[model samples]
Target: MTAFVLVSGMFTGTHVWRETAARLTAAGAEAHTVALTGLDGPCTAPAGGIDLETHIADVLTVIDSVGTAQDREVVLVGHDYGIHPALGAADRRAERVGRVVHLDSGMPQDGVPALAAVPDRSLRARLAAAGGRADTGDVLKPPAGADEWRLWGSTAGVPDATLDRLTALAAPQPLATLLQPLSLTGAVATVPTTGVLCTRNGASIETVQMMVGFGDPALQALTDPRVTFFELPTGHWPMLSAPAELTDVLLRAAAGEGHRLVPADAAVPPAHLRPFPLDVPEALRERHGNVDLHLPDADGPRPAVLFVHGGPVPADARPTPRDWPTLTGYARLAAAGGAVGAVVDHRLHDLSDYERAAADVAAAVEAVRADPAVDADRVALWFFSGAGLITTDWLAAPPRWLRCLAATYPVLAPLPAWGLSGSRFHPARAVADAGDLPLVLTRVGLEAPEIAATVEEFLAAAEDAGADVEVVDVPHGHHAFEGVDPTDETREAVQRAMRAVLDRVGRHGAP
Candidate 1:
């Protein structure tokens, strides 16, 4: 049996951990719940008087008071606001705490407070006003109407009676707890961490990565290779809402089962890549502007493939490329082929934004290279359909890290819609600037009429320009045939192209 220290967030005590702890204890693991002072019963401290150190001490005391404190493996689990104290304790007792599970809570980074990390200004303001220590005295009640089941919505799968009990047993939390800044060094990060995301809250490892755009240290923790991410399809309080499911997740996390979630077969994509965050606006969350990494099994640094999905014209009901059946299927195929697959998202609406689209692809490349599992020196780019137009700039001035580029049914010429009238896009002109960069062009016989002339012209120009270009004629294939139909021939062609790329990079076999 394992041991777990369960910590609760604000407005609640060990009571909030009742359901989860019971389940853990039933599984033969010793579960200890820490209840901070002045949170449950009567209190003397002013609204902002209860500092974070006090809570940290509470958690530490529990850590020591438990049976044979150091006799067994221990995992400290923090939910919501409780993460602060748990973090401090983990830092102070780094050797003893084997793993820290952050359950749907924001990880306060160095020099950043929990409240300040929140991106939503209005929500931040509301939390501040509700519990501002200077204004509210020592403690603040749960936000008005927030305790009701409706506030939690459909995500809270718990019964009405459970919700009522939770609301009734809630206590006032110290404002200082929310406002306090965490003090952390490299030690806390050294402790293995797992992020248990609650799906309904629009919080996931991916969302945290997206939020990292604002330079939030808290969200940056998700990038740690030692960190594992899990998703529970419930509201913020899964302990009460979905005890059994949450319990299983907790057990698996304790057992270090996260790495198994992403299999070489690419059977099931993790939840982080599945649902789109609800908080982001549709325009900002457009399916075309996202990027994801699909890693294959690796013993060390391995060759990587950067894939650009086709479709130059944007569609209204466009699904996220990560969720698209064809794109993800291709990613799985790449994994099976023994290369780290990276799928990139870019603006497909305004043809003029091709430069920005190129940047998105570059960003994905950088992100993939950042992974220790990928070989920084060897990476290939595979462009599909109209997306091939975005790679002309890369061909013109190739980076040393890029080995080769492969295109399938590409649009090699710029259209009027691309807004390049004065400086029209032309890969034929860039062929001379390609500078020995290996290229493979796969042209389909049933290609779109609008781009046929340009493809033919570019092929002729490349032959004369002394550029090393290999052309593969898929006579029966159409634009996006692999994604749409994925005929046996198309699959074989893709496999051959990838193998050729690996052979060029000298990394063909699996490690």
Candidate 2:
């Protein structure tokens, strides 16, 4: 007999698990839902406000009572913020837990507080300002309205009635529960783990596997046989949107019957770290602060292409984007074609860093144009991946020197979870303002659904505005296909995009 313990994320409590728990019970499994202090039910928060430890203890009590009485270990399932307390409890009583399931949540590391999970930027800033101190008596309130539900997580596929009920029953979460760092003795590492990804909420099984393929030491542990994965087609709140499906996944996860990710090949370098697909002779390089200029062999003042690498890349990422093979390869390719290739390193370490990143890129462009070896009157800005958002500014108002704009596997619109609904970085919306500025976009067939949706949105906008846009298709390519999928199609698309940009740059006396 399998005993399943459920823990609901921030705001609501055991009540949120009603449908899923009932389904589990009907399936002949023992279902127990935990009510964290100050959340749902009659449990009042103790003086000084309940912290993470209090919630950990709350889960521990249930685990002990159920495990002892039934004489069986339980499968602990934690959803969203609920994963914190569940992990803390599991760490403390690893022997009593059969498996730990992470439902639509990130893997919380030791010493990191649950506050990192808070999705609202304003709310996060406020909590950080208060220092999450219990003495501050700060309580983070749940989303008050229907529209605000997305601040917590994606509400895709969730019914209006469910959203109303969730909003009504949502409780105020103590700052302490979010502030206190999770403590672990490392005992839970040996426990079999299962991850339940919510695709519409921005994460999917494929993304996770791709990250693992990055050769990131931190993510390599996920390739372990003990770590299995299951993906839900719904959003963050699976219990409300697809209770039956959630129940089914949970049952299979408990049985150790989920998908396993293949370990990355040790011989081949990680996709991003791999050599660029194109083969071009290296160009003479000169560094100008954050920007690196790859000069063509032929001298007299040549046109330049400023390449902006995509990110939300970690501040401490190795080799930086300027040094990456793909960027350098493109730079070399541009130089080989009689144009100076300029790669710039920007501060796009977080989603919020787009403004600073744009400033850095603008500065880089000026530096490239000011160089004696480059033609100041002819320049093209090429963006990649997330860097595509920065193109909004250039697209809205094109300068005479700006010949063309190119993007490869770009994110033209912000995803729902990013909370950037009305921001200035929306290139899809900004495309309407682009008047006759030539635009080139290289789209991959195997791109992530969310990113692909943004590309589609941008294409529709471009069509409506009658913008001079040329679409280059990589039929069987994936995002970052330059290094990941090295096929003839990928090579042809790359060369085609280069020719289009250079052709625009070659035009004399541009408008």
Candidate 3:
């Protein structure tokens, strides 16, 4: 028999797990819902007195009381903020834990506080400004109403009554709980782990696999056989939105039955570090701050293409995008033809960095146009990956000097859980504003579902608005196809996209 211990996240208690726990019990599993100090059940601790240690002890007490008799397996399931304490306890009692389930939460590293996981950008910024330190009397209040639930996590698929109850029963989180850094002795590393992704809450299993391909040393552990993944279609609170499904997933997870990600080949270079597919000759290059210019061999002024790389790339990613072979290859290909090529590095370290990144790209364009080697009036902008969101600005207000725009595997619209609704970055809606500006879009058949949906949405909007758009299709390519899918079709798609964009700039610029 499997004994399950449930730990709820911030601003809620075991009350939040009532439905799911009942289902688990009905399914013949022993379910014990933990009531963190100050959040649920009877609490003798004063306001702000319950730090992470208090909650860690709370979960540990429950684990101890559940007992390991009859050789029963104990599964510790942590949801959101609850993962901190759950991890804290599991780290200390790794031998006793059969499995540790990360339910809709990131793998928190040692020395990071729970505040780092809070989804509200403004709230996180405000708390960061205070150094995540609060007085003994201070506490973080939960969302005040139904509309504010998004301030925490996506409320998709959750019924209206559940949202109301959640708001009404929400507890003020102790400031200390979030402020304290999680300390791990590394014992939990050996324990079997399962990641339960809440797709509508901003992450999917595919995204996780994509990140693992980035070759980040820290994320390499996810490739371990001991780690598995399960995705829930609902939002953050699966207990309320999809209790039965959540219970089923949990049971399967405990049984060690879930999908495992294929480990990236250690012998091959990471996707980003691989050589660019095309073999174009190098161009005369110059760097100005964050931008790199690859000049055409000809002396006379020429048309230019400014390439914008995709991101939410880690701020510390080595070699940067401008130095990457893919960007440099595209730039050199443009230069080898008849035009100058330019690449710019923008600060898009987080989803909220779009506005700032857009500003950076705009600044880079002005710098590129001002160069004596390039024709200011015949410049095209080409975007890649997440940078696709930044294209909305250009699409909404195309200047006369801007000749053409190109996007490759771009995310034209924000994901549902990104909380970017009504933002200026919706290229699908903004496409209607693009009057006479030519758009060259290169789409891959094997693109991730969420990203592909955005491209389709943009295409539909473009068709509805009668926008001038040209599409180059790679029927078997994946996102970042240059490195991942190096086929004749991939090379042809790249060349075709280059020709289409450069032709609009009054030159044939494909090598």
Clashing pairs in 2: none
Error of 2 at 206 (Å): 3.2
Worst lDDT run of 10 residues, candidate 2, spans 41-50
Q: What TM-score does model 3 achieve against the real structure? A: 0.86
**Residues 1-511, candidate 2, lDDT per residue (tens digit)?**
8899999998888988899999999999989999888888533333456889999999999998884654565999999899999999999888889999999987899999998877766677677788834562457667787787886788988899888888888887877888899998899897899999988877778767756664456777888888999988788899999999999999999888898876766666666778888888999999989999998988588899999998777666677789999999999999998899999999997777888999999999899989998889999999999899999999999988898999999999887666566468899999999999999999999998888989999999999999999999998999899989988999999999999999988733332
Clashes of each: 3, 0, 0
Error of 3 at 391 (Å): 2.8
Residue lDDT tens for model 1, 131-220: 543542455555333333233222356677776666677777676676777888768878988889875554444334423322333334
Error of 3 at 68 (Å): 3.2
Q: After aligning candidate 2 to the native by TM-score, how far in Å is the CA of 201 from where it should be?
A: 1.4
lDDT of each model, Cα atoms only? 0.67, 0.87, 0.87
Off by over 4 Å in 3: 41-48, 130-133, 144-146, 257-265, 273-290, 316-319, 352-356, 416-436, 456-468, 471-476, 487-492, 508-511
Per-residue lDDT value at 296 in model 1: 64
**For model 1, the run of ten residues with the poorest summed lDDT:** 277-286
CA deviation > 4 Å runs, candidate 1: 41-48, 67-70, 117-120, 126-136, 144-155, 204-225, 259-511
76-109 in candidate 3: lDDT tens per residue? 9999999999999999989899999999987898
